[model samples]
Target: MTEPLPHPQLLLAIAALRDRALAADSLNALGFSIANDPYPLLQYHQALVFQQQGQSLELLCVSGLARPSEDSPYLVWLQRAVRWIATQLDDDQPRWLGRDALTPPADIAEGWAEWWPKGLWCIPLHDRDGQRLGLVLFLLDAAPAPALQPLFEGLWRTWAHCWASFARQRRLLRWRPGKRQLLLALAVAVALLLVPVRQTALAPAEIVSREAMIISSPIDGVIQSMQVRPNQPVEKDTPLFSLDETTLNSRAEVLGKEVAVADAELMAASQRAFDNPQSKSELTLLHGRVQQRRAELAAVKAQLQRTQVRAPRAGVAVYSDPNDWLGKPVSTGERILLIAEPKQPAMLIQLPVADAIALEPGAEVTLFLTAYPLTPLKGKVLETSYQAQANEEGVVAYRLLASIDGQPEHARLGLHGTARLYGERVVLGYYLLRRPFAALRAWSGL
Candidate 1:
């Protein structure tokens, strides 16, 4: 004998239910579809969907509602009823449950007549692996025919697959941290931020001479030559550099001729004074003119002597490349070089304004030389500029001087390094946020 063909409406209803279940992208959406989408295939007064939580069922959705309200009397009663029924079931399957078969607790029994119909068809949902997914309760006026059990089972199993996938996806997509854990983590982070830390700032530094004699141009003239090379040791009165003497020599020669001419005129007046009494008066005027010319000559000679600069005391010459200064014109008192004691090298730091911190005299400092970075040299702040100025690098910075604790063999004049200056203690949060706060204040003018 051939099997009877399924009804066209039943086939359409089954296809529709399957389509909705497959289309659901989230656990909540799947629960809603499961609760309401089966109405065409199976006529029921109401439907409730539940998810299996450890040892109990959690009411997930109710038919005809987007979401089941937690405080709804109907939902609250269904949750208790479904949970109790889930525990009483012996195996994972679909079956018709009569209201009379259940000896519910007093709380549940009191509302049974008012809320439910004669019976409900309980369908247990499971994944392909036989893991229990949840339960679906359909409140029907009459028990479903046994022949439809296979169709109901097949539909719920398909939904279980979708439910399992959505549940796994939901867990992977977001982290649901508990309230206590979140609070504890936040508390720990805040405490760490409040920790006391020593504030420090880094600046470009160079080993320099302390209290060294500064060599400057004595007159406004062009530099002719440098007698000593950079870092060359010299004794007292050693020739360091010389200014161009071509003009000074020419001026001196003219002054000398004027002095000679003044003397000759004075001699003639002195000789004629005996011959004419009027010449005596001329003699005094001529003598004054000769004295004036001699004074001018003396001044020129003094300037000529100052053209050749010499070291006043014994030390090493500290300056940049000699080629930079050669042929360069300099004004009087302009710094040319330094006669520095190499053994007493100090640190010259150019602290950028953006990285500037509260610094005071005698504050701790550490020097990390580019050449010998492994061995750090300790120092103390000797002086700090009251104002900021642009450095050689064109960065606006404050000039700071620091005294080395002890003389190191490699600590010589003109050696460059990085200086870490330590300031007063502050909270870690402030130390990290100090720059950001300063930038914000500057931008917002607050």
Candidate 2:
């Protein structure tokens, strides 16, 4: 400015000012620039600065480069350079030259050789207190002329004072993906361990009958007439069917005549005994004849009554066949019909033994018929056997009976359904906890 500086000096001064501006901008934009960080914009700016200063630059300390030990001769030379720069500043302030002759602290120097190699020049960055904070290692493709050294030194002095502020902001704003992922995984694990899980509910029951029987005819003859049809309600002594009785009636009439004559003879003998006062032999013979006639009469009457079959109790009559019965004959002991009383209707179920024991007298039962799924019929536990019986499939099951509550309109005498016997109501937690163990036991045949 005073009479203008010489041409080379003016050029040098402009380049240094440009580089200073660039360094300040990079510090504002990136906050901090580490030695080996691959920031393209910062690298481009550094290239500009190098071109303005008439120096050729290269970057050697990139992230993926191979490493060398800290004790190498090259690092020894760097320590010497750092010592020389430290002596140039004022008493309270320190400086650094971008050269291999600067020494770094032991902690920072330990991994330095691996992060940096040949051609890297160190510039010491310092805070307001003149304490060394970090080092910026610039690299060059060829040795710089001695003339550019003073410009670099002046730039370092200006930028080094701002390093502390830049570093603090960098530390606060940094995003470390690897560290964040580790913390997230740890949090997930803790949440899983703390969460509580509940148990399962109880399983449903099963029920079977022990005293089911099929009724049959005892003789072979034409039905003649049917006194009952399928599902017909009847009471005890109700005539179920009647065979043709023409032949039986004729035999009964002859037996009645013989009985009448025997009675007349017996009466004559009794009167004679009273009149004569000593007719013992005649009385005995008359009594014997009377007994013979009575026996014959009873036999014929039994035969006649056999033709008419009657129901034993109040029940719904169900014929074995529905085609016809008015003129059909059924053989002895053949199952021609069945009468199922409402009070004694068959309550069949296939119950597990463990459940059967819990079923006591008067235990509540709910029946769900396949025909009427929506309509639930009520019942009570009538009986249960202590021992288990092997079913047709050879599976052991206990027999049980439940008396139906009201006469359900849709419940046919022989209808099939499932009977849900209500046992004790327990905590839902117990059933869930024991379910797995129970299943395991069953699978292992324990």
Candidate 3:
């Protein structure tokens, strides 16, 4: 059933209240778009929102704009105001504070107060759980404008809740270290300086001979036999390998027959020169032919002598295996094997360009061979490449040499290992962050 119609004045009041409710809903529905509005920001000069973050408050926006990351003069001046906000009553609400009464406790308080002598309207926002959030501030003019007071007073508490909710979603603005946290950070900084760290780099290494001589094929031939096995101890003049001598012997027989024929012709030409004066020129030409033939014969013989390869000095034949070389055809200058002393085995390292570090002569080197990983080898850096180039694995690297302090009994040529090169002592922090800091500096051009 319908009750009696309300009085006209009562109906008007009801309509006004409905309008206010609709306005509040519209303002709240504006959402984040309010940050882009120039009218409110221009009229208010600046509107700031601060939100509660973990253990601290974050500044969300100022003058319809998102807060900047850089430190500003305003934040330095607002420190006192922030402290007051932190210690406010839990039941605090919005209010207006005059610039004269609200004295900021900071070194620049006089200048800061002068700039805002007009005063500021403060709105204290709270969550539904009754927890005090942060504040929404608006700058005022020299003459106190009470126009916005009623707008703030008449609105539903939910209207203010929107600003609080938004502030909570913004990025943090500032960090202030407490006494305990400051002390802990200071202690850590000191410890980082005290710790001793070695500046080091890593590279792949291999066992190498210090006074090794490479044996190469002097003449093109197929291997007939392996006179000495790989890693076999041999004295100077020991037969290392014999090339196939079938061609050498056949060619020698042909040369011998040619030499005999040339000598017979020269003797016959000498007799003819004595009998016929015109034949003397022909006799001299025949003698010249004989000499040329002898020179050719000498060269063939010299090559034949080199068919049986021999060690130049007393050392170990450093080839991989006999099966690898036997019956295989080799060209001139092709390396067959090495003759290493085995008395001094050094380390050859290929330091990649990305992992390069400054190394001085006599710098310490620690290496671990794959065969004897349990035992590490100590060495001293002897040399480093002046440039970067590709290594055996086709990776860009710098060649480095290090001489081992002592030789191991089981050390063999071509054995692979990992080597660590030490440069100098550095603070723990610098040692750890050196690369990252360098990269940052390069990218930022700082």
Model 3 over residues 1-446: C-alpha lDDT tens digits? 97455457644543454344444333233222232332232266566656655656666556544545536766765655655645543465666656666655665456556555465666666677766665666676643334434443443254355545444454244457899999999999989777988899989999888889999999999998888877788999999998998888888888888989999998987888878988788877888888988888898889999998999999889888889888999999999999998888899999998777778889999889999998888989998889999977899999888988866775677789899999998888877788888889999999
* Whole-model Cα lDDT of every candidate shown, in order: 0.88, 0.57, 0.73
Instruction: Kindly report the root-mean-square deviation of model 2 from the true structure over all alpha carbons.
Output: 20.8
Candidate with the greatest TM-score versus the true structure: 1
lDDT for 255 (candidate 3): 87
After superposing candidate 3, which stretches have Cα over 4 Å from the reference? 1-183, 186-196, 321-324, 327-329, 437-446
List the candidate numbers ranked by TM-score, top first.
Answer: 1, 3, 2
Put the candidates in lDDT order, highest first: 1, 3, 2
Q: What TM-score does prediction 3 earn?
A: 0.57
TM agreement with the true structure for every prediction: 0.61, 0.37, 0.57
Q: What digit string (tens of lDDT, one per residue) describes model 1 on residues 1-446?
A: 98677678776778778888999878888899989888866789989888888777888888997766788887678767777778766777777878787778888777778988988888888776777888888999888866676766668778888988976786778988899999999999899889999999999999988869889999999999999999899999999999998988898899889999999999988888898998898887888999998998898789989999999999999888999999999999999999988778899999999999999999999999999999888999999999999987899999999999976888877878899999999999999999999999999999
Each prediction's RMSD to truth: 14.9, 20.8, 14.4
> Which is better, 1 or 2, measured by lDDT?
1
Off by over 4 Å in 2: 1-225, 234-238, 243-290, 310-315, 322-357, 387-396, 403-408, 425-446
lDDT by residue (tens digit), candidate 2, 339-437: 665454545666755434255688777777777779967777777777888776676777677766665676556666677766665444443445566
